[model samples]
Target chain A: MNRYGLKEKIELRINHATHHIEVDVRDTLLDALRDQLGLTGTKRGCDMGECGACTVLMDGKPINSCMLLAVDVMGRNIMTIEGLAQDELHPIQQAFVENGAVQCGFCTPGMILTAKAFLDHCSNPTDDDVRQAISGNLCRCTGYRKIVEAILDAASRLRRGKRHV
Target chain B: MKTFEYITPETIDEALELLGEGAQILAGGTDLLGEMKRGLATPKRLINLKGIQGLADIRSIPDGFLTIGSLATLSHLAEHPLVAQHYPLLIEALQRTASPQIRNIATVGGNLCQRPRCWYYRHSAFPCIRKHGEGCFAMGGQDRYHAIFGGHRCFIVHPSDLAPALMALDAEVRIAHADDSRIVPLTDFFVGPRDSLTQENILTRQEILTAIRIPVPPDNAYGTYLKVSERKATDFALASVAVSIAWLDTQVTHARVVLGGVAPVPWRVKQVEEMLIGDELSGKRIERACERAVDDATPLRHNRYKVALVKGLLRKALHAAHRSREKGEK
Candidate 1:
């Protein structure tokens, strides 16, 4: 209770591939992802849950990491934009650049992460599916048409891979 | 934000034991933490209910009750096949609340228990009746999206669309105390601002809302919920309705009509229910029922548009429900 404003012991594993950290329960997942763990890929745009700038996957589902408390995600497996690329760009990231989906690149990480989550669930998505997939992410410099193209193009590649195998 | 003590209890009893007058129980933190950061809601202690064991499950109980855990996210409710099949009104309401990202972290319990979205209430400078001060400034200030029914001390409409749909489905609450539990109807869950001007719910500070139970209606029931708002989505409803009609071969055997964004609570319509009883849902009957929706509405200066909007949406919703009754499972 006496150490660094911690009233209770909180054992957390954030961006777990990198490090194990201990934080207070009051700290949000966005804080742990940005400040403590230095996994700044998760942007902190709106501290409120209005924007999807802080989107992350907890146990394979997309959620607002800003609205989530660090202690709430204690034992849950977390995946961020950093976890998506392992010295190699993911298919969605590749498609984003190939289709000119990213502009200003501030909202790209969150949009790409949201797309990855959707593609993980659905391989063959229609235009409406692509629109619905990234409906939460807001691109101010606005590359929606390109984002939809990238997701549909990636869906084709993924489906072709499955058919070849 | 000022630093406060945090506790994550794994059981309802433990969470209740930690709650007190100024201690807030954290369901989803979608509302509480944002308020804390803005200096709008300053609770001394935050009791996190996430670590609790059974507060996240959604299952059907015996006696035709669909029990929804308090920790069940709005995203789950929006996509759950069972909820969509049984209560389409509820699904539509959940679909229209905020964005997909916000729904992922917002809890079903917290959605109903949320404070008003009034800019003044969040700003804390208006000295509104909600802040335990003088009268609301929205009365004389820019009051575009204020109240139209059953609002006196404060004129903020309820922000939750899911709350109205759930109320129309005859939902019940499971409030867990330290050593006991109690069940109350969803309509009776909220207290008016004129009643207390501070407290929004009837539950004590120590009671944790464990679960919600929605009674299962008959199999051949048709329901439609619609909200007419300003934006395409991600905005609160200017006016909303959840109408569930039990269709027996052709006629509406049973009807539950409830309105949202018209008052501080879900603002049920008893006159509409009485008007629709034992009558076939023709175009004229639907129009008659829609007219009765705003019979008791006392619209404020800027909110008079809501009455006509509410009438049109209810008429459209009734027609949609009637079409669904004839179409059978789209």
Candidate 2:
């Protein structure tokens, strides 16, 4: 057993793009996305899955990226914060901005991704539902009131089927 | 995290063959990865079972059993229409589990097989009795979350929210070895602290849990799962209760009361179940049963509050079951 570690080349389909990178067998998806692929938008807070800052979409469902190995996600559709915006800000991001949901901006990417997944499945969610949906992602700033408002606002805008910049 | 050889096995036989002394089965990697990162588990090889086919399906098998594959994630199980229709107790427990992100990846088998979240056992510095150390630190240390029942030498409480609900529903699990497999009741799968100090479940290092089999609930049966935790998401239960009862014309025909976060295993109160089998769930009857639920609980220093907490949960659960029976709710 080599002490330094063993590396394997694997292809990851992240954010609708395929990238083949050499990663250590022990490297988590969060590590690979940040270090190798330079997708630093996904933050890593409390890598033990307690904090959802490293959350990303795995097959249209939110999952903590830090708890999964880089090699584990092969041939699966993975979407991150970067995939939501094509030319302008996505509706969720716009709602977050308009509602002042972002204070430190550290948890923005993960919060947006989590809200996006929740709003995709539940179109008419109550305030309690949005609060429960984003319980995993923690923001020390904003006290979560604005985050809740942003998600509810985003849900209404999404129900209208309009993409606002 | 330490470097290890990771292999994705495409078959159950291949996965079992690869398991050995220094190997660990990786399912969902929600709990196992955390242990690896904390240096609590240092395996040389990781057998990733996600590549196996037919291990993540949720379908009805023969013999009126709805068999849930071991690899089925909690989110999928909670969102399954059949699960919601057949067993809402399971859905209630699953929704109150970790969080949406964790439920999306945490497997049902992995949830049942997860180690205790006891602070003493988790920290490497303590080396408590569960970790093969000399003595249990929680016995004399901070024991706010320790077990109030079934504590022999260790005081750690079982952390899984799904086990109690499954036990109440009389679920069975299939464990697979190299060439053979056996089905065991979900109640028998757990190992109490008195029986074994090192392991929580009866699964050997090589055996892998394959599927969970739940019989279709009987008609006129009402069940509910109630949990009390510090926070709504990403929190372990302080005290929880799962009650499944069947009544015909306001008389109890069957009852199963299982309590969690108060014992080393999901504490099944046959005493309370027997008390409710022949009588109706009236307010006085429920109060007596709730008091009987904690008669044998020997609380540690800081967890005496758990006795009252668990009793409160039992009262609420029984009341819910009572209301469901009255309204003819399935």
Candidate 3:
């Protein structure tokens, strides 16, 4: 049964299309991004906040949507794992797929989005920066060395493209 | 999580008016919501303070202070130009708190006003005194993260990196009551476990922290917050110190030594401050000050190592602050 006082289906633009879905303030953004929108790219490994499998960009910064309320994100530019690209994969996403960063595939989306946020702000981040950027996202499948490499690789590739243009 | 009545007021007075019965303020739901999720905190109403106007802006006052709205998230603290230039220790402390993801939504007021993160307090099974019960099991149970000072009855640390740094920076907290407003220094903001085992800070029920005001950094002042933790981020400091040191050339003009992970409040070392002042801030003098920092530490059975760890952290903080001072105002 729908919970009482669940506000009439709030209109949220996911990816490119707009959809009307009912949600309570208690329901998290991760719940709507996955359960309602059917965009399961954002994984839900640990419902508890420990694991960052459900990280997403809210207003262009990385946040654990599992810990954020969907109702609170009204008018904010909410970008998800699915919103990272449309016609093609995000360069970071492609790097993840190519560099074998996707082990169990549970943490790939959050990792790629987090990397995008980092590189978008810092074109050239040191090892400490890279470590700090993705400290929230955990991947038990493959050691973090590969994930770090892909992000650094993608960052350089993007910078080179900017120069050539 | 239990469903409660939700009210998002746009004005501070309106939000304060909605208080009387059973309502909890929700600001950047980093801590309050966590309590509700575990059924640890179940107010009859949930007051969303995010939509409240004028509570998220950051600006400076002509009186040599920077005012941070209660709703200003930790991310804002790290990125705001005034905070970055005037209070680097505050920024470093926020960086020491959770990761970038969590910091994006965690508010500084909530961080300072956060409830105890003790396993006993969070878990429902434990009848912890922190949860308004008879005794705190952490005294004999798993207490690796318990307190080292002011724990005559209960031994829980403050658990926020920003609090210690604010204390060192001589910040003041402003709160809005039902009819009036009052301000207090950062050190006086905390209430010890012995004082009120149920509350973390000294905010009244209807009162809400409207803003935190940090004074302008002292001339020749250099500040740094050093936290040692199990992980890079998203973990509380095992032993953290926010050290602010100022000097003309060799002799110390002022020094603020605030320690976290060692007590209920931001434990300041008076003797440590005494040992450093009027003396050259060389490595030798700094070492002597560091030893004096933990002279009064009386750790329990398990937390004995915290004394040495805190001392080491203080030395690192002094050197870091000294290094930052080398590049003075330009």
> What are the Cα lDDT values of the candidates?
0.82, 0.91, 0.82
Show the colliding residue pairs in model 3.
Answer: A9-A21, B98-B234
| Model 1 residue A123 CA deviation in Å | 1.1
The B-chain TM-score of model 3 reads 0.96
Specify the poorest-scoring 10-residue window by lDDT in model 3 chain B: B321-330
Candidates ranked by DockQ, best first?
A: 2, 1, 3
Backbone clash pairs for candidate 2 read none
lDDT of 3 by residue, B1-330 (tens): 876767778889888888876788888886776777788988777778888777998899898789999889999888999887778788888877887888888998988998877788889888888787888788777878888878867888888899999999899999999878999998889999767888878998889999999988778888888988888767888889988888887678898888887788778877887788787778887888877777777777787888889878888878776666665531
What are the root-mean-square deviations of the candidates from the true structure over C-alphas?
A: 2.3, 2.2, 2.6
TM per candidate? 0.94, 0.97, 0.94
Candidate number of the best lDDT: 2
Candidate with better DockQ, 2 vs 3: 2
Give the DockQ-based CAPRI class for model 3: acceptable
Q: After aligning candidate 2 to the native by TM-score, how far in Å is the CA of B227 from where it should be?
A: 0.6
For candidate 2, lDDT tens digit of each residue in B166-268?
Answer: 9999999999998789999999999998789999999998799999999988779999999999987889999999999998899999999999898999999
Better of 2 and 3 by TM-score: 2
In order, what fnat does every candidate score?
0.45, 0.72, 0.45
